[model samples]
Target: MKTLLNVLLRLIETARILGLNYRDLKNAEDLLMHNEFGLCFDTIITQMYEYEIEIDDELYESISKIGDIMNLKPESYTFMKELIRDESNIPKPLKDELTRIITSLIE
Candidate 1:
């Protein structure tokens, strides 16, 4: 089972991939430092969606695992749906992953 630490590590990985410094996610970092795991997770997830950073297959899988550790916000579905619908832009595997997440959310 994925843990909160795994989620935090994934978030840091995402920040690096996005070329964002760890300090840039100050709110999430502070929340995490304060042991506010849920809030920190939510903040990082929201920031990622809002940033619309490019996601590869590996990162998508990592995010899926992180999502399993915490209930994803409804916004995640909307954002993922947008990605899945953009067939020209998203890879098949990534779309499949998003579909899996959406199906799980509804179940």
Candidate 2:
């Protein structure tokens, strides 16, 4: 998931643009630990969609290039297609439940 690192770096820019809280930092770590590039990319995309923000094309391109160089499996691409067909609906696993879970744990 080397490409995921590229995506994460770009996500920092996205966070700045959106002025999000520090939770994004924790989310980034969780994504890395999980090694779930597709799932987490979908989550990021879905969150941007919900917030009516534009996706960063350059970051996306960087991720795609890395995936190609590393010959990543088709899993992420396949999921992306499904998200497109479903009109960017956030899948169940990518829901915001973690934020609540983490919040509760911290509290």
Which pairs of residues collide in candidate 1? none
Candidate with top TM-score is 1
lDDT of 1 at 60: 60
Each prediction's RMSD to truth: 12.1, 10.3
TM-score of each: 0.56, 0.42
Candidate 1 error regions (>4 Å): 21-24, 71-107
Candidate 1 local lDDT, 70-98, one digit each (tens)? 67655553453332234366655567889
lDDT for each residue of candidate 2 in 58-102, tens digit (9 for 90 to 100): 545654554565466655533333323233565443456677788
At residue 49, what lDDT does model 2 achieve?
Answer: 46
